[model samples]
Target: MDDIMRAIFACIPGMRSPASPGGCLSAAFGGGDDDGEEGEGEGEDRISRLPDAVLSSIVSRLPVKDGARTAVLSPRWRRVWASTPLVLDDADLLPDDDGPQIFWRDVADAVSRVLAAHPGPFRCVRLTNACSYAGSRGAAALSRWLGVLAAKGVQELVLVFLHAWPVRVEPPADVLRVSSLRRLYLGLWRSFPDTEHLRPGADVFPNLVELGICRTDIKAKDLDRLLQCSPALETLAFVVSYNTQPNVRVRSRSLRCVLFWMSIAEELAVVVAPRLERLILWNGCPCTRRVRRDFRTRVKIGYTPELKVLGYLEPRIHVLEIANTVIEAGTKPSPGTMVPTVKVLAMKVRFGVRQEAKMLLSFLRCFPNVETLHIMSAEADEPTGKLNFKLKFWQDVAPVECLKAHIKKVVFKNFRGERSELAFLRFVLERAQILQTLVVVLTDGDGDHASQEELGNRLKPLIYSTHRASKCAEFFIFVRCGGTSWSFRTASDLSRSDPFDC
Candidate 1:
C-alpha cells in the first residue's frame, strides 16, 4: 500500500514532497514503517489505489463542505477539491435556526470563498432559498457570483429563490452571454435582464439545449428575444410565468418538446416548430385556487407535423385551434384540416356523473389516433348512486378509429366503482378491439381490503358478461395500503411480473 501510494502521489500534478505532513498519501497511510524508508507496511489504503479520475468523481458528488474537507486528508488530494467542477447549493451550508440576514451573509461568503478557491471549469452551481434577506446586496452578490461562474465556463446553472416576497436579484449579463452553458433554470425571479443591445443575428447561448423559467416575471417580448437568440434550443418550459400578453407565441424550428404549467396567458401560439413532438400543459397551481381561472387559456398548435404526445390537458382548455380552425367538442374537423399526430393522450375529467361519459367521449374524438390513454379524475369521487351510465350513451356516438384499431393501453387513476365509471370501463373493454392492458387504480378511500374485494366482485361480472373485442386483454387493479400503493407492470410495459390475483 505504501509503495502504491508513493507511485500514485508521484503522478499527481503538484503533489507536495512525500515527507511533508500535508501529503495526503503520507497522512492517509503512515509515513513509513519502522524501517524509516518510504515503502514498508502491510497497512491498506485501498481507495488511494484507484485512478485519479475515479477519485475526483467520488469527491465531486459529495456536499461542497464535505468535498472541501478532502484537502486535509492528504497532499495529493489537496488540489482535487479545488480542480473538480463544483456543484454548490446555499441551503447545504445555511443553518435552520439562523436569522434570515445572517443566513444570507453566510451563504454569500461561503459561495465567494468556494468560487475563488476553485480554479478552471465548473459543471454546475445551484443556489436555492437565497436572497430572502440580503436585499440589494444579495442581488449584487448573485450577479458577481454568476459573472465568475460564467468566466469559468460553467455548463449548468440553477438559481432558485422560494421566498413569498418578490426576488430582487438582477440577472447577471454574463448569464445571457455564456457560450458553454447547456442548461439553465432560473425560478422565482422578479424579472429578466434587458438584452436590447444584442445584435439581431448574433447567437446567444450557442450550445444551450434546455431552458426552464418558473414563477418569474419575464415579459412576452423579452422571452421572444431570448428564444430568438438561442438557435440550438430544443426543450423549453415556462411554469407560472407572469406573461400578461393575450397571446404568447413560441416559434422555434429546433424545439422538440414544450411544457407549459400554471402560466397566465390567454393563448399559447405555437406558430412554427415543425419538429415539435411533445406538448404538455398543466394549469393546476399550488399557491391559490384563483389561478385555476387560467384554465380557460387556449392553445394554438400550428405546423407541428411531428407532434406525438399531448398530455395533462384540462377539459376546459381542450379546444385547440390549428391554423385558424377550431377543434372543439361536438364539432367534427373539416376535411384537409391537419389533426394532431398525437399517439399518447393524457387528460383530466371532472364533469358530473350525467356528463362524465359524454365529455370523455367528446375529448377522445379529438385525438383519433391516440394509442395509449391515461385518465385522471379532476374532482372528488362521486357517490355510486349519483352515477348514471346507460347503454344509450354510446348508442348515438359514432365509432372512434383509435379505440377499434390503435388503443392498446388505458390507465385510470383515482377510480371509484360508480355507475358511470363502471359503464365507461365496460364500454371501452367491449369496443377497444386491439386493447392489451387496462390499469385501474382505486382511490384512497376505497383502499381497504374489504372495499377492494367488494369492488373486484362487482367488476368481475361486468368483465365476464361483456363481449370484449380483444380476447387477450387483461385488467389490473392497484390499491393503496398504509399510504403506499403497489404497481404491477404489464407485458406491454416491458415487464414480466405475475398478474395480480384480483
Candidate 2:
C-alpha cells in the first residue's frame, strides 16, 4: 500500500520519486544524503528553487541577525540575504541575559558589519535600546553607520531609547541630507539642534513624508524649521515631549494629518494646510484636581478648507479657535480665506457647566456641515456644583444649521443618568431633524444587569417622549461589562412588557 502511495505521488505533476536525482520530494522525504555533497544521489533543493524575490521577502521578514545568518544555508541564499533590505533591531541581536555594555557592542558591530557588506538600498534600519547606552563613541559609530545607510539609500530609519536615561547622540547632519529617507522616528533623545546652521539655500529632508518625535526635547522654532524644510511632509506627530516655545506654529500646504498627544506646548497654531484632513489634540495632564488652571493649551486651526475629521479634544483644551472668522460663523468666505468643511466632530462636554455646555453650541455653529457628532460627557468634580446642562440654554442659542439639516448620527459616551445628561440627549433628539441614529454608552456605575436595565427604562421613556423630527431615528443603549466590553441593544428590539430586558 505504501509503495502504491509513493508511486501515485510521483506520478502527480511537479512530484518526483525518491530515486529521482535532485527531486524536491526526495530531499523533503529524507531520501537524499544528509551531508553537504555534490554526488549523483543528491535531491534538488526545493527552497532554493523559489524565485529570488520570494526568497528575499522571506529573509526580510526575519530578525536582522537571523536574516543575515541565511548565508550559511547555501550560495543562492547567501546572495539573496546580502541583497535583501536590512532591518537591524538591537533587541533581536542581544539575549535577555546580556548586559548593557555587551548589548551596545554587539548591536554596533552587527549594524556596522551589515551596512558595510550590503551593496544597496536598505529598506529600514531600526536601532533601539542601545541609544541610551550609545555614549559619545557609540554615537560616532552610529553616525558612521547612518552615513553608510545614506549611501545605500535607506527609506526608513527609527531610533528608540528604551532606558530612562536620555540619549546624548546628536544625529549626524547627513540625516537631514538623506535624499532617500521618507519616514523617520526619533524617541527619548535629549534634543534636536536648530536647522539655522544649515548652509544657505540648502533644503533639508526634501523627500520626508512622515516625521514623529516622542519623548525628545525639540524647540518649537527648530521643529517649525524642520517642517518648512520638508515640503513634501504629510503627517507630523509629537507626543510626550517638552517644547521650548510656548506656541508652535505648523504651516504646511501638503500636510494632511497632525497628531499631538500629551505634549506640553502652551498653544499650537496650524497656520496653513490647504489639503489637511485630520487634526487630533489630546492633553493627558490631570487638571481635574488642580485649583488653578494655568496649563491650558489652545489649538488654532487656519486655512484647512479640505479638513474632514477633527477630534479627541479633551476638556483640557481652552478652545479650538478657527482663525478664519468666516469658517467659525459659517458665512460666505472671502476669495483666499479657508473654511473647516468638516464632516465628523468629536469633543468633550462638561455637563454641569452652563458656560461649557453653551460653548458646545458655539462649536456646532462653527462646523455647520458636520454630519456625525461625538460628545463625551464630563461631570462636575465638586459636590456643590449644580448640573448645568439645561435644555433651555440650547433653546436660547441660535439654531445650528447642522442640527436641523446635516447631523445624522450622535454618540454620547460615559452616559451617567444625570439630569444634565438626559437633557443633552433630549435637546439633540428634538433639534436633529434628519438624525438617523443615537448611541448612548452607559458608564461603569451601571455595569450590573439590574442597573443597566434601570438606566435603559429611564432613557427609553425620555427618548420616546422627546419630539424627534426624524421618525426613522433609532436608539441604541450600550452597557459596560466588568469595565471591559460593551453589550448593546436597540430600543425597537426591546419588549413592551419588559423594556429593560433588552
lDDT of each: 0.64, 0.64
The true-versus-predicted C-alpha distance at residue 409 of model 1, in Å, is 1.2
Q: In model 1, which runs have C-alpha deviations exceeding 4 angstroms?
A: 1-43, 95-101, 129-135, 164-169, 242-246, 292-295, 335-340, 351-357, 380-388, 471-502
Each model's TM-score, in the order given?
0.81, 0.78
lDDT of 1 at 244: 43
The list of candidate 2 runs beyond 4 A from truth reads 1-49, 96-103, 135-138, 166-169, 199-202, 285-292, 324-340, 383-385, 388-391, 394-397, 444-458, 472-502
Strongest candidate by TM-score: 1
lDDT of 2 by residue, 79-115 (tens): 8888887766665667646455464566667667777
